[model samples]
Target: MSKICGGIFTSHVPGIGKAIAQNLQNDPYWKPFFDGFDPIHRWLAAEKPDVAVVFYNDHGLNFFLDKMPTFAIGAANEYRHEDEGWGIAFARPFQGHADLSWHIIEHVVASEFDPVMCQAMTVDHAVAVPFELCWPGKDAFPTKLIPIAINTVQHPLPSPKRCHDLGKAVGRAIESWGGNEKVVIFGTGGLSHQLEGERAGHINVDYDKFCLRNLAPDPEALLQHDTLDIVELAGSQGVEILNWIAARGALTGSVRELASNYHVPISNTAAATVLLSHSERVLA
Candidate 1:
């Protein structure tokens, strides 16, 4: 059976993608932010999971206010990145693992987590940016991708507990699949910063650091946080940390933090990244 070997957690801010695309990694202003991913690249090269179950949220790209899903999983054979009007371009399309996607859909749904199965979806920066950060290359993505988008944009977002529960279901689904694919789950978005209203530049670096310290081994403790608390402490968009919680839940058992980083003002957002490995080796 296919098994989830590990997971990656990071922010999906668009500015980071633009800096890398423009080759500004060496610039002092951007160096510290870009430098954080170096260890991730090495880790990706070493682990090289066959498929990445990327957990991200759409930002007014595909699902608008008209319709939004609380939880959605992409079952497409291929996914093309949509232009979020940023014009920061040139990441190739992502290849999707359809068989594994279907297997996961079946098991996850049966496991009582009802996620809308998307066969065709145009991914936005939420999906593309983080992919570039971890597996930077132009030819093609080194690993196939299965995007699981959570509804962080809408007001009535899922609770942190719900996201974590769904993630655990996904981990179970991946493990139950009778395939040899090595799977890695990713929870992308948020270290803290609100991008709207009078508090456009609000950031809570201390809370973000606190989250980073506990996310690996004590994710359940974070479930105590509600949307209101996150907004007040972190910022309105700061609730995006729910994505990180979901990714943490997918790791299955105890996780070892391989690498972690944090940077503020990555385009008005406090971006962060953490790499985790399952304490017990998961073999296919």
Candidate 2:
């Protein structure tokens, strides 16, 4: 039986996790963060997921404004860095696993979810941050990655319902895979914050926590709302909540809240983290 080890929701605010993980490597606030993750760490150590299907958004790094996709999947054997306008600082271009990725595409499409297939794509902070967090020290994980890129930075963005539908497709796809390796489907993004234009330093702990409370099970309830509502209440860029809905759709039943941490003001972003695993019942 294939079990979803768990899911992680983090802000890929470029160097946030890297810095936090490094600081926590030998610090106190680490407890607020790392300490909560002990159970997940133990689980990770034990289950050792063989693959992670990640849901992230790109900031016009790989595919430019020239042609954009609402959601895209890598269909190549290897993916390289796109200069990112700063050249490859992290240097090692992220590699892709074709067999499993193809399987996801085949199965997801069979479920009627059509995702844009990418052969050549570069990545930006959205995708980079999460990968670095999950595989700090680089070769630590014995898992292959399937990146699902959502165009969060650019508009005419996909509707919340669309994202949730994609999530259902993703979970269904992974469940159909005929493999023995454990897989963790992660959706990376925000709880609540705005980092652009005039509203730059936005932070609402109450809203962030409220989101965490509703996110695990009642996320579909959010889809009934629209962009105007989100931009007005959660900040324009805060529309990333769609990423979380997509994640929730993939994992049904109960979810165990593993680790959670929230921080204010981190390099043009407000940040938060939460780890969830499929529970026999709802997370408590």
Top of the candidates by lDDT: 1
**Candidate 1: regions farther than 4 A off:** 279-284
Q: Tell me the lDDT of candidate 2.
A: 0.70
lDDT of 1: 0.85
Q: For candidate 2, lDDT tens digit of each residue in 104-177?
A: 88887887876898876666666666666666564634566678887777777788888888887877677767
Q: Where in model 2 is the C-alpha error above 4 Å?
A: 17-40, 80-82, 91-95, 138-140, 279-284
Provide the overall lDDT of each model, using Cα atoms, as 2-decimal numbers: 0.85, 0.70
Clashing pairs in model 1?
none
Clashing pairs in 2: none
